[model samples]
Target: MSQAPDPTIHTLSEFLLHAGTNFQFFDLGRGVHPLDTQLFLDLENGLRPCPRPRQQHAWFAIVFWSEGQKPNHYIWFVKFPIDERGLLVAAARNHFLQIIVDALGQSLGEEKHDTLPDNPYSFVPTQSQMALFSAVTKSCLSLPFNDGVKEVEHYVNAPAISDWRKLSVQSIADFAQTLRDETTCHTVAQNMALYHEDFTRILLESAEAVSLPTAFKQHCAQYCADTFSSSPALALAALRALSSEQADTISQTLLNTLLDSKHADIHVLSVIAGRHYGQLSGHRLIQFFERAAALDEDESMEGKLFAGFFSDLVQLPCLRAEVLGVLRSTERSEVLARAFGHLFSQTQKK
Candidate 1:
């Protein structure tokens, strides 16, 4: 006689596979983008660390659906803590899995559950984040674009007659995902500067989710260069639009120029640290904190701003070592050293 199959789900991916559902994973930590299935599996199995962690946690969203006479789709926005090495804590994962098993039980994929049960691991994304996630997931699944896509297309094609204010965040997000197409990218690049600053800002913000084509990246770099002196705000907005992973030489030079200038305010430094962090290393990384320290002296924040920003950056696995190196470096400026000392004192007090 054969023994019964062992009823065990070792991982979330295993659980989903066992339930006979189609699914996809999106990393919500750094920026909204598709997470590779294999990479996620490796993370779950302790094979590797999470590549993009935010606030010391690996935040991600899982979209899954069952196929049958009546199909049901569900999304789970969850976060799990990561240790110093950026590895996900297995205890949290096991706890969440236990919660799912208790709530859904044997009917995991068979029943249509309109709402997810209460759990500590779950979270609700912001409206803009939700909109972008929806647009991205739909595009990834090859589903039809929402109504907002048409409006965005028409406006980009003819900006003068269109009302930028009428365009919704959802529409901009949908259009951002379409930048992968050559024609769409060219049209947007040609007309990007013509749109109102507000419209351009939203478009660029949404564009952060997708890897921009060469034309779009060049246009954004040019926009930053042209407006940096005349309209710093617009230049900042354009900078926010750039993707850290796709920063070409021109973009890197532009960022270096911005940091080298006395006008690199706290906001500029913050944007660089937040969005274009991958570019921060070696001389560039040192220059970033130097700028931050200078701003602290001028702003009269008592080094709080610098300390807070440093604290946040040090939590990131990629930047932690570099940030510490900066602190230990004898080459750092006197102001930076003072700032580091103050940061140390603050930490000791706490």
Candidate 2:
């Protein structure tokens, strides 16, 4: 009998295209189809051949077979840029998402299931994703998100994860320093909140990343340690991931870090803190809560959010307070409506 084909393979840029591009396999080798071969070939050739098409941007990614127990596995998606104009391409904007969705889909095609897996790929170990995304994201031009650009955005700004490993300590430091700049600060903050992988160690390892201002570094350390602490072990991992010296300071923030916690009681404390700090950093705290709520992805998540926010928000004297009152009740309107009801009531009182 013929032996099965080698299951282990490295699907980097060139090889990924070779294996999955415009093609798919069934049951390890029973069937095949060329879905978009011509398009890929034409695009590849147009971008490469001739005197150079002067493409606006570039991207990269690393795909590998994840081996583990259970029905689920991971497909690591790393994106980065190659040139100065990497940021200018519209495709570079949402490139990470599109690339990840398409790449992972194509990469895992018919391997485990003929249909798409319910939770195909999520931004879990988000550092690898963020590092690559940040690298490409850093260079993307200042432009609004457009539908036309969505398709190519992810693939347009990818980098080999190895490239992130190659980045210099000083470069990482410089990025931390850029955290001072409003632009970079905004970018880093968003990434921290959005794509955090729960493992801050990789981001923190480079002592270079610590070059950020005291406050920025503190923010990042606490944010990472708190946000990724999904389980007891992961929470321990998150705590350990903080800079050794900085861990103590982060512990203090742990009191206020409930904004992102999954636990209900801690969330109540965050609500209290957010009510007081909400107008200033309160919004950020709320953003964290809302993100957690959305990510919780079910009534369970919302139940916790409602209980926490409902209980604590009322103790405060703001518009949020009234909204909580409505949620506490069975009012069948949107939260925004309740928020406005509070606003309108206050207006009439004035």
Candidate 3:
């Protein structure tokens, strides 16, 4: 008798081939995009870097369709960290694959039932995140929107219903996906301020994954600016949800607002650094660096803010280069100089 495949293949594609007959992969890191298994394998072998690198980690989902009576598809949500080189860390992926191998044994393709225990390798996304993933997945797979979409629209359109809690996050996600439609975009823009904060946040969070119409983006920018004046927390949440293009103007507005505040909060600055770094214009970013330099002299929370911003900025080559240039050309204070030097040293050691 012929021996079965080893079932211990390290790469995702090979593991899937051994485990199931049909499968689909989706990337959930920065946005939702269909990923080819071959490309993923290439990433594993260090033949190529991850297609889109973000936040030093990647989120992905795998749909395994093993022929069975009770359940046909098993969905796995996984997050793996990337190395400094932007390639998948072999150890992280290997750990996840080992979990699957241990659970199912070698006969992975011939499973009789589809059931999974509490898996350590799997992660549960927040309601807003899950909504974004679902909407993107459906669009990528050419599947229909979920049944709850219409209900969400009804709740948002109805001023009579005072309770925003009635609307589900999924419905908001589906509605966001339709924002690509000009009519839907206009309608959402017009009714945006009327919605409750909770509802607006859901919509904004979901909007991050897809491009919004320009008119609608303008509305979001306005909302973010207004909210920042009233509540920086809500404003930051909305700001993070914006697409790169949309974030540019919104970020400028938020930065100006935050700087004008009596005492700038470190948390707010940290959020902007972590989420909206790329959205910032070069001029604005240099202004931020100057502010950091000044703050460093004061020796307050400058270290915390600089660390957060540096961590994110250093990951991008262009941004990293900008920081290096600033370190070289500008006459930074002693505190700022040491901070930048330490970051560079740590990165090289890594």
Candidate 4:
């Protein structure tokens, strides 16, 4: 009788490779962006921290499939907590791995396991998020486009005849993920003004998850400026759709304009903190906190807005040091200073 193969699967990456599977990792925290395989291995091995954390946790999706088999992929939506310094909590990861080992043992890759054990670490993404994730993953694998892609393409090509309301969000998401040519991007940009508000909102929301072409970004920056005062919601959606990297002069200028607004409301402030926190640095970083602190003080809410956003931003590995520096800065305005004091007082009470 042949001895049972070693049941000791050490890491998720190892388990996948052992199971004769090809896999991809995507960071679902801030956006549905692909995660480098090596970086994920390093994170699992405790060699480094999660680079893109949201709400103090590292949320990611693993899509895997067997080699030389039909393209029926399986996904695991897993989240693990990060320490104050942003390192993965080994205990939580170990617990999850132990559960996997107990459930599947040494036969993990031998057969397709459609479901994982129910656990707190697993979560279901929103419908829009799911659509975006599926679109991105399929695009990465060079798979055939979903049927919705042609409908979206038709709408983009000839919006006069296409019924905008009939376009499914999934098709829009697939188009956003697969769009690459400058001509297609230009067409999308030129047609933006003609799209219904509902269609435009869905398009912008879908665009927020992917890296767009330069032409598209430029047009979006202009669109955002055109509607900044007249249509704040549409403007905000446009801002969210703009690349967080903000590589060009126009994008950077628009972001600066939003941040520098003295009358920035909670919606504007939250969008900056959530979608574009990556743009915060040096003077811009200080400006963001200052603007957040200067919000119209509600007697009932007090410093909750500032404190809540601060707590979230400070937990990010990329922003932690800059956030701490802001906290210790002497150049803060009187309102900002008072907000910090209230934050500290509240923390102590807790």
Candidate 5:
């Protein structure tokens, strides 16, 4: 007997479009955001690269359903690896869709999960990610009034300290998305001092991957600068928020300040390296490595920071070559040499 090949669809959007369905796409790489379907199509077609590339992988989700079945929409959270240039690995996506077809068949329905096979590509996001995604999805679907939206709008305006527990994570995300308003921006800045550390941490994580408004960006830079001298933890949190928006000016200034110091703070260095390193100028990267190498010893705090930062920067699509160039240069530090050797050894295995 001849076995039949598995049925499959190619791109996710293709599957939805074929059924004349409605859909929402969210990019889950750094944080959740409404991904443009055209950009996704371009990525699948090799006409463009991933817009927000991180570690050469793009994580995203798509929710789709028939017109009357909004509540029953299917959500698929998948992460796909890209090449050095940020293009998707075609075979990987194809294989995933093929497996999905084999397991779940050609149709989507409320009963689909009953027969669906265990999928490697499906993922459960962290609590913060789930909250942010929920916020984005609600906005996209234009569902009935969200209490989170109403509460955030009021909270930013009134500046109250009732209880951090009372505020929803979705509200924080909603507030972050609406920071274009000057009043909201000012209110949030002013109220940061009153916020609990846990609340601040959650908000920072939500804001970390979002695009802040220009006004908010300016206010944030000033606020973080002033606070950095007093509270380094809060400053780093604010920096993480700024980093995702590609806030180069403030981040660059901070990086320079740390590089010029003999005893740099490891926490600050790690945040900058993990979040802002992708957008750093090549000159800054060169200067950074040189300064990092000048640290007292390979086993010191500065050296540990350098290793952590370099390991992260080496994985970014934009910085891979720049990192390699620095690694191969004669001036490379012993600490960096060790990191470089480990990175290549792992790469060779893949």
Candidate 6:
């Protein structure tokens, strides 16, 4: 939206209509509550394709979007407007931003100010709507949020953005070391964490497959694993940076730690990965499951990798009927259900 001279009258109506839902002339002022999580989940989780509506209106929603930025679960403040083609336009439908802008009377473009501007929205944010927007802006500035923002930013315009492919293990090792550096700005740490998924992708898909130093691999994997052990919330970041864009050695290293081995936290990290990353890379991890299924039988204390992530992934037919038989023969329904919920929540997206 262009900068309007009148800024005091922030229209929540505009924000609602653009936030995703099927409605006609819906009033944001009526029959709704801000941060209606129950309403939010009802609209979001059961979504099929947007049925190109003649008209669309709903409140500024915090959607758990499964599209764009792979494995990224987004709380989109989207505007779901039907184009002439009967398509629900994404970018065109955002409503809350205008409200925020109008409410604050701030300019929509680049700021002349050097420091972060105090966000002007509501007196008290209803939920994560403001925080999500704040993160969107700060994604550029480098800030840490939850790891669910996992994605590979293949920026078309900025090709020169640090090509993780060209880096040696030494360079990545250097970057990881810098995560603890006192002088490294918060902006720098933010950028480093953001590149987690991109780096993982580089490791997975690289043609040349950068060769990493053993020392670097051990250092990164250990720190990330330690962090994962300490905080499952940080696992996505740790996995992304540790496995991404580095050598196969690095990817294998982390996978070995998480999948091949078993700790409660390691299992939790694996479950989260299968939740999000499974959306993109489930095919790759299937074999890891097969190996675990065979090895983890009897749930032995001596040695057994948990197949929670794997069992769910291989539920689809094709590779092995015997595998299905083997999967069913086991009676670990609770563990299996937990895995299913995690995997289902992530992949049940579609």
Task: Give model 6's TM-score versus the native structure.
Answer: 0.30
* Distance from true location, Cα of 1 in model 2, Å: 75
Which candidate order results from sorting by lDDT in descending order?
A: 1, 4, 5, 3, 6, 2
Candidate 2 lDDT for residue 306: 42
Query: What lDDT does each candidate get?
Result: 0.80, 0.34, 0.66, 0.79, 0.66, 0.36
The model with the greatest lDDT is 1
The residue-by-residue lDDT of candidate 6 on 76-190, one tens digit each, is: 3333443332233444333434444444344322132112233321123233224323333233224354332221222211224745455443223223322333333233333
TM-score of 2: 0.21
Kindly list the per-residue Cα lDDT of model 1 for residues 79-168, writing each as its tens digit. 999888889989999878777767676346445443557888898999878988888888887766778788888999999988888889
Runs of candidate 5 exceeding 4 Å displacement: 1-8, 45-56, 69-73, 83-86, 113-116, 139-145, 158-161, 228-230, 244-247, 258-267, 290-311, 327-350
Q: Show the colliding residue pairs in model 5.
A: none
Q: Tens-digit lDDT track for model 3 on 1-350?
A: 32333646667678777655677788776556678878777877878766545668767888666655643556678877878866788888877666665666644544532444556557787766677888887776566787878877776666456466766778778777877877877776777668777777778777777776767767766777677768666676566566563346655765766555633455555555655566554556655665664565466653555665666665654466675566665656566676676556766876
Error of 3 at 113 (Å): 8.5
Off by over 4 Å in 3: 1-8, 18-21, 31-38, 51-56, 66-72, 106-121, 161-163, 245-277, 288-299, 331-350
What value does the lDDT take at residue 171 in candidate 2?
Answer: 41
lDDT tens readout by residue for model 2, 1-350: 32222244222233345344322211100001111334323323333211111121222222233333422322332222223311222244234334434434434553532332233222232343344333323223121232323222221123222234444323442233233355554444454433223222333432222224455545555554564535443333233223321224443465345444554344333423332232213333344335434434444443444444433333332334444444344433344343434445654776
List, residue by residue over 1-350, the lDDT tens digit for candidate 4.
32333456567888778777789999988778888899998888888878778888999999888666565788899999988878888789877776776676645554546667798789999997898788888888887667878888888888889988878888888888754668888888888878888777777777887777777888888888788788888888788887574435666677788778643678877777777877888777888888778773543468898888898889877788999999788788888898899999999999
TM-scores for candidates 1 onward, in order: 0.88, 0.21, 0.77, 0.92, 0.77, 0.30
Model 2 alpha-carbon drift over 4 Å, by segment: 1-170, 180-182, 193-200, 207-222, 231-251, 255-350
